[model samples]
Target: MEQNLQYFLIPFLNWEMMLLIWVGVFAGIWVGAIPGLSVTMAASLLISFTFSWDINSALALICGVFVGGVYGGSITAILLNIPGAPAAIATGIEGYPLAQRGEAGKAIGLCTTVSVFASFVGIIVLAVAAPVIANFSLKFAPRDFFLLAVMGILLIGSIGGGDPVKGITAGAIGILISMVGMDPSTGEMRYTFGNIYLMAGISFVTAMIGLFGVSEALTQFRQAGLKSPKQNLDRIIPSWATFVKYLPLSIRSSLLGVFIGALPGTGGDVAALLAYDQAKRSVRNPSRPFGTGAYEGIVAPETANKGAIGGAFIPMLTLGIPGDAVTAIIIGALYIHGLKPGPMLMIETPHLFWMIVSCLSISSIALLVLGLISVKPFAKIIEIPKEIIMPVVIILSVIGTYAIQNSVVDIFYMIGFGIIGYFMRLYGYATGPMVLGLILGPMLDANYRRTMQGAEDQFLPFLQGFVTSPISLFLTLAIVFLVFSQTAVYRRWRGIQ
Candidate 1:
């Protein structure tokens, strides 16, 4: 215990490490607030610059970026209705409305308070329950992952603003688009159409930039006369009563976030969306109607996404499996530093695990202080003229898309997606489901194919695996329950309708 305490205290005692974490958090806020410049991108960039640094300092910076970036995404979502990251999509549903009503300060303040609380929730879970969750996750089969992807696809109902059919259409289109490149497992061209660039497949980041960032820019052009919302900055921190009012919901949503974040190929985006849906269904006496400006809405998603920060680290530290793209990059950093990250990683290098837990805890604390301090400046950005900001936003989108692979083709593709997203939004189709489909499509396809191969391409055997494997059976049942919960009868039973 004393040795573990030493590992945890190392970062707190090192001024250089502490400074890097604070700097990373500050930089991450700006980066994440800019659409298309995602947490994954920031962490990847850190790797290039920090490769020669000691592993501990590098990790401290990355941890700060991870925590701060996740929270920073909400800043734009609340202020401009454009989600800086997919995880913030649900935040915008309520947050942007609050901003429009000139309550951006209160909304953001509450979000920060709950987010910090949830980050601690995730850290505690990581410290206490990580090994158990890691072992349990290891039991998940390929079929189970495929099932999980299917469950994620069903979340279109939650994210889609209206018209389930249109949502399904958009989501299906996204899934199809995800198949545009060569097949990874079979090494065969899919929808590549003989284009060399197509063979590498589309970067989802580029699509996200187009769909959420540039598309939002184009949509704003149509609302030319609309002025940006004025913010109330006097009371940017929540009162104890306000925090207490939402404590229960924060706890529930945050725990859900931690679990979802620990899932491989899943991350804060899914967790936030799920938490939002759960809050919408569960909160009976909301401060306001959900779509307009409900505090419950912001609390659920912000807390969930923040909680996912610690959750993402659990699998990375224990099982070598990345919980999300940011963690995947962190895995590469570990490898570059001559460290293996599998089950033996913790047993052989116990200090690394404890140190990560410590760093994430410190990062969360930094996020609260830095996040609150930036609220006024961030809120002010919302007041910028659309004519000036929109063009800059588009340029940022172009740059962010290009940075993914330094490809000009991706910029064109991003522009094309932006155009499509604009038209779709005009036609009442929400972009959220489509992005969800794109994110989960590859995971679904790869896992399904692997499971099928394991079953020797026999249909019956593939189905049987769901019943044969305990983990697969549990997931299958959960999927069934999820489907059932969507029915009118179930809603009626829960008194939701």
Candidate 2:
């Protein structure tokens, strides 16, 4: 405890580290609350900025942004019905109700508090349990990874709560988008339309911005001059009684967040959605339905999404496998600082490991303070005019696209993709499928190719594992469930009296 406490306190005394953390926190909020700006883009930008900094300072900045970005999303969710990040989708459901009811301050405040508490809890879990979890995860084979991928696919239900078809279609589209780059197995180009820029496939971050940001901006034009109604900034603090009342949900969601976040390839979005679904199932309240603004709804995803912070760091520290894109970047930062991650990392650089964990814990406290101070200003951004907003968004989109590689073609690509996203939205097709496809396309490509390589053109032995391996069996079942989720039989089964 003494040694751990020392590491925990060390980061606080470093002024350079502190400034970076603050920069990350505020910047994360600014970008993350913008509908199109995802954490991945922000982190990607940080890679260039932090190239010259030492590991600790760089980490402080990145981790602070990561924490703030995850929570910054809830600001937009509460202020507008649109979720800044997919994780905030649940927050919007519960938070928008609070906003509509003229209690925006309390809703934001309570979730902010809950988010911090959940993040701390996740850190504690990571500090205590990462090694055990990593050991178990290491035992997982290719079949297990495939099963896990299937689980990610199944999350479309959570993503498409009201419209299962839209969600599945979105996921399918995301898969296709993911396939845009080179064919890993055959080394062939796909869906590139013969452009040299298409060689890298679509940028997932760019697509996320176009789909969520640009498309959403266009959607706002439909309601020109109509803003999401603003509410009085009520008591910023939830009453102790109210806090106690939702404590159970907060704790449950936090635990759920950590578990899902710790799983490699799954991050806060899935954790928040999973906990949201679980909360909906567990809450037996016929008196107040979820969407109409139950406190439990507010508590569930808010806490869980924040809870994923600690969980995401587990694999990054212990196994060097990033739990998410943000953590993946952090891994790169660590390498730049001359810290290598592997089995010997624990023994070789125990102090750095402890310091990283400690810094994670500190950022949570910092987020709570930062969140409260910024909530009022954040609420004001809701009133910003769209005419001014869309132009700036388009500019940022162009700049962000070009910034990725100083490529002029990417600017054209962003504009063209933005148009595609806009048309897709107008026709009632969700852009989510395309964005998801962008994220997962490479995973499917690489893994499927590797699987084939092992089989050496012989398909029978590989086919045998689909049923025989526990992981493959689980994945196959998940695919079946996902495919049949919209069918009468599955719906009937799920809706059984």
Candidate 3:
């Protein structure tokens, strides 16, 4: 225990490590607030330049970036209706509406508070229950993962706005678009019509930038002369009563995020969406109706995504498995630094584990300070005139789309998606479902195929697996509950309305 204490204090004692962590957090916030500049990309780029740095220093920096980036993604989602990352998509559903109502400052303050609380929750879980959680997560099979994806698909009903039919249609279209690449199992071409770009599959990030950022800009152009909302920056921070009201929800969603993040191949995006759906269903007396600035909606997703930062590190430290893309890059960095990252990693280098926890702890504190300081400025952005801001949004969308791969073709694809999104919005179709579909489509397809192949393509065996495995059975039942909960009968029984 004394040795572990010493390990945890390493970063606190080392001025260089402390400075690097704060710098990384500051840089990560801006980077993550920009579309296409993902935390994963930032970490990967840092690895290239910091190849010669001490492993402790490099890991400290990466840890700070990981924590800060996840929180920063929500900033634009709130003020501009543009999610810097997919994890923040659910945040925009409620946050943007708040911004339109000129409550951006208050909304952001609450988000920052809950995000820090959730980050610590995830860290505590990582410190205490990481090995157990990592081992349990390994019990999840392909069938279970497919069922999880199916559960995610059911969220279209929750996030689909007022039109269920339109939402389903948009989601179906997104799934079709996701199928435009070569099959992973067999090298068979899918929807590619002899086009080289289509063969590589559509990047959801490009589609996201177009559908959210560009589509929002175009929609604003329709009401070009209308003045922007005058944001009220007073009382940015919530009261103790307000924080207490959301405490239970914050704990639940944060725990949910940590567990989901501990699962290999899943990350904050999935956790945030699931938390949003859960909050929509469970929160009885929200500050406002969902999709129009419910405080619960912001609390659930922001906390979940922030908690996911710590959850992501769980499997990486304990089992040598990456919980998300950023951790995967960190794994590579570990290798580059001549350190082995696997089951025996902790035993061999115990200080690395504790030091990371310390770095993340400090980073979360930095986020609290920095995030609150920026709330006023970010809220002022919502007060900008539509004519000026819309064009800037469009320009940023184009640049972000191109940065994905430096391909001009992606720009065209983005523009096309933007136009489609505009038409869909005109017709009352919610674009959230389509983005959700794009995000979960490949997971559903790949996992289902893997499960089927495991059963030798026998339909009976495949079906039986759902009942035979405990994990699969639980997930199947949860999916059933999710679908049933959407029915009017269920809503009536629960008196949800």
Candidate 4:
């Protein structure tokens, strides 16, 4: 215990390590706020220059970026209708409405506070229960993963807004679009149509930038002359009472995030979406109607994504597996530093594990300070005239899309998606369901196929797998409950509004 304590204090004692963490957090905020400039890219770039630097310094910077980047994604989601990351899509559903009503400051403030708290929750779990959680996460099979995807698909009703038919249609289209590449198992062409670009599959980030960023700009052009809302920056931070009021929901969502983050091939994006859907179903008396500006909507997703930061580290440190994209890059960094990142990692060098906990702890504190300080400035962006801001948004959207692969074709695809999104909005069809479908479609396809292969192509055995395994049975039941909870009978029984 004393040795671990000493290792944890190393970062606190070293000024250079401390400074780099602060700087990384500051840079990460801006990078994450830009569409397509992901935390994974930032961490990967750092690895190039920091190859010869001390492992401790490199890790400090990466940890800071991980925490700050996740929080930064919510900034644009609230102020503009664009989500800087996929995890923030649920935030924009309610946050943009709050921004339009001049409550951007309050919304962002609440987000910052809950996020910091959740980061600590994740850190605590990582420190105390990492081995146990890592073992449990490995228990999930392909069939269980497929069920998880199905649960996510069922959320179309929650995020789809008022028109269920339009939402389902848009979601179906997104799934069809996701099927454009070659099959993972057979290597057979799908919807490529002999196009070289289509064979590699569409990058979801490019599609997201077009669907949310560019589409938002085009939609704003319809109300070009209208005055932007005057933001209320008076009460930026939430009171103790307000925080206490949301304590229960925060705890529930953050824990959920941690567990989901610990799962391989899943990350904060999935955690945030699931948390938002759970909050929507469970919270009976929200601050406002869900789609208009519910505070619960903001709290659930922000906390879950932040908690995922810690959860992601659990499997990475204990096992050799990378929890998410950023952690995958971190694994490469470990290899470069002459350190193996497997079951023997802790036994070989325990200092690395404790130092990471320390780094994430400091990063969370930095986020609280920086996030609150920037809330006023970020809210001011919403007050800018549409004529000036919309054009800039469109320009950024194009640049962000091209940056993904340096392809002109992606830019064209983005603009096309933007136009489609605009028309969908015009026709009262929500774009959220489509984006959700695009994100989960591949997961559904790949995992289902894996499960089928495992059953030797036998229909009876494939169907029996769900009931035969404990993990699969639990997930299957959860999916059933999720569908049943959406019905009028359940809603009435529970007195949910």
Candidate 5:
């Protein structure tokens, strides 16, 4: 216990480590607030530059980036309706509406406060229950992952806005677009159509920038004369009573994030969406309806994604598996530093686990201070004249798209999607479902294919797996309940009206 305490104190006591963490968090927030700059990309870049740095320093910086980047995504989502990362897409649903209603400052203040709380929740779980969660995570099968993806897809109904049919149409189109690359297992070209650019596959990040960032700018152009919403900067932070009122929900969503993040191949994005859906179903008499500036909607997803930051480390530290893409990069860093990651990792380097926990804890503190300070500036961006802001948004979207793999073609694709998104909005189609489909389509396809292959392409045996395995059975039943909950009868029975 003494040794563990010493390990945990290393980051807190070392000034260099502390500074690096703060710097990393500061940089990560900017990177993650940009449309195409992702936490994965930032971590990978850090790995390249920090190749010669001490392992402890390198890990501290990366951990800071990991925590801050996830939180940063919500900044753009609330201010501009463009999520810096997919994890913040659900946040944009409620947050953008709040921005339109001139409550951007208050919404972001609440988001920052709850995000810090959730980060602590995740870290506590990582400290206390990591081994158990790691063991349980290994029980998931391909079919179970497929089921999880399906559950994510079903969220179209919740975030679809007013028209269910249009939402499903947009989602289906996104799934088709996601299929335009080579099949992972078979190496067969899907919808590539002999074009070289399409052969490599469309990046969801590029699509997201175009759909949310560029499209939003174009939509603003249509309402050229309307003044932007006047932000309410006073009373930015919620009172203790307000925070306490949402405490139960914050805890629930944060736990859900940890659990989902621990699942290999899933991450904060899925957790946020799931949490948003759960809040939609369970939070009776919300301040306002979801998709229209409800505080409950903002609270659910922001907390869940922040909680995922801790959850993501659980599988990576305790087992060899990465909980998400950022952790996957950290695993590479571990190998580069001549350390093998797996069950024996903790046994061999006991200090490593504790140091990570300590570093993440510090990162959360940095986020709270920095996040609160920046809320006013971020909210002010929403109030800028559309003539000035819209052009800048377009330019940023282009830069963000091109930064991903340095491809000019992606910029063109983003612009095209922007045009398409503008028209879709004009016709009353929400873009959230489409982006969700893009995010989850590959997961569903790849997992379903792998599961089918495991069953030897036999339909009956494939079906039996859902009932045979305990984990699979539970997921299957949950999916059933989710589907049932969408029905009118179920909604009425639950007093959802």
Candidate 6:
């Protein structure tokens, strides 16, 4: 395994792979700076153009963008309320608050430092631990996955920009939308309503584009071209002391990121939120309350979100299960190049796996350098006129979504989601629940069916399994907390007592 891992990571010292990685890095950064464009979208878009490329070169470029774009979303989320990607929502909770307070540059600096560092940790863990954990991860059958997805969806409460109802509502909407496509087991159409387009259901990327892109444009217009702070930022870097303070938390979050990323269906957004919640719980003094411009607020999610990059690859390489949507698409790319990802893949494609591991570490280093240099200038972008900024955000969002499949239908999907997202906000509904639900819905469906099948008509084992797993127990408690948070009695009791 040791010797084989090397073969995969260093298959060839070719210029093409290096160039493709660079291209992905650049494209990811650019795409991530805009609202609605996500790492998944960027990876999917690359799939179209790279049908003929060498497998190693394709992996290098695609993975580079995947890592970069996840980090890049924080750039806009910190500078503007318009999150560049869904995973940046948690960042926006603290980030936009800082931006509103005219500390956009400071927030950007802190986030950049953590993001790069966390990514480095995640990559290191992925490289070192893949062989050990890949098989363990596969132990998660459909039932386990379903329970895991439910646990992940519960995270919606914290991610709702501080509201539970809106998030849950949005999540319900997303689940319903995901249900539009044919039932995987039943082979029946539930929500297509005769349109072939609806048969494919609502893609999360399009919904995200609408929720972040269109809603943000309307929001900017509401500001009526309001002037923002004139950021005179230079030497915008986080202090070493700050990095030292977050080192422990960063490591913990990176671990969480890796595990969550390794899980099928869930991704960076979930990892970031989970890390943020853990940070809130673990920090006794907190330096300052989170969401109040605390450095911890910036570091926690930044680290976890980027750490998810490595976590996401673990399952993809060894188990042939795409950890998330982006990896799923990349899996397709791998097969297109005559490579398969599975248990046998380790024996047949060992070199491919190591190359990916190596690329992850290299990318993290690159992000650190690029992130430090770019964060200040990116934050300064808030100074652009709302009229100009809003329109550009919309255009980029449309292009980014459309770029994924070159489909005008996706642009329309984004528009629809935008309108829905605007109303959700107006009505005090959170988009967080919706996004989380959308992400977890398919996982939930697949796993639920599998668990039922495994039970052989007995429900007790299914219930027993839910109660037995350590991860499941912790997740169940989390779900309980989420549901309790929404209770009128809970709100009133707290208010009065």
Candidate with better lDDT, 2 vs 4 = 4
Q: Across residues 1-497, which tens digit of lDDT does each residue of candidate 6 receive?
A: 77855564472466677666666776788778776566776787788887887777778888779777887888877776667777787787778777777778878877877787788787777778976666677666676667667766766755665666667777887887778888888889988888898887777767776886688677666667468777747547867887798799888887888887887777887788777766655565665667675666667888888888888888888778888888899888988888777778867866777788777766666677777777666776888777777777788878877876778988888888888888777777866677667767877877788788877758898777777877666666776765675466865665521
Runs in model 2 lying further than 4 Å from the true structure: 13-20, 35-54, 80-104, 161-163, 225-228, 280-282, 286-299, 385-402, 405-427, 448-497
CA shift of 223, model 1, Å: 2.3
Q: Total clashes, candidate 4?
A: 0
State the weakest 10-residue window (summed lDDT) of model 1: 133-142
- Model 1 lDDT at residue 460: 99
- TM-score between model 5 and native: 0.98
Q: Could you tell me which 10 consecutive residues in candidate 6 have the lowest summed lDDT?
A: 4-13
In candidate 2, which residue pairs get closer than 3 Å at backbone N, Cα or C atoms, i.e. clash?
170-433, 174-433, 174-436, 174-437, 175-437, 178-437, 178-441
Off-target runs (Cα >4 Å) in candidate 1 are none
- Candidate ordering by lDDT (highest first): 5, 4, 3, 1, 6, 2
Report the lDDT tens digits of candidate 4 across residue range 236-302: 9999999999999999999999999999889999999999999999999999989999999999999
Candidate 1, residue 261: the lDDT equals 92
Model 3 misplaced stretches (Cα beyond 4 Å): none
For residues 1-497, write the lDDT of model 1, one tens digit per residue: 99999999999999999998998888888788776788998999899999999999999999999888998889888987778788998899899889989899888888888999999999999999998987777777789889888888988877777688899899998899899899989899999889999999887777877888888899999989898877789999999998999999999999999988998878998899889988887787889977789999999999999888888888988889998899999999999999999989989999999989988888888989998988888788778988998898888788877877788999999999899999999999988888888888998999999999999999999999999898889889988887888888887888764
> TM-score of every model?
0.95, 0.83, 0.99, 0.99, 0.98, 0.86
Better of 1 and 3 by TM-score: 3
Candidates in order have lDDT scores of 0.88, 0.73, 0.91, 0.92, 0.92, 0.75
lDDT of 3: 0.91
State residue 446's C-alpha deviation in candidate 1, in Å: 1.8
- The predictions' CA RMSDs to the true structure, in order, are 1.9, 3.8, 0.9, 0.8, 1.0, 3.9
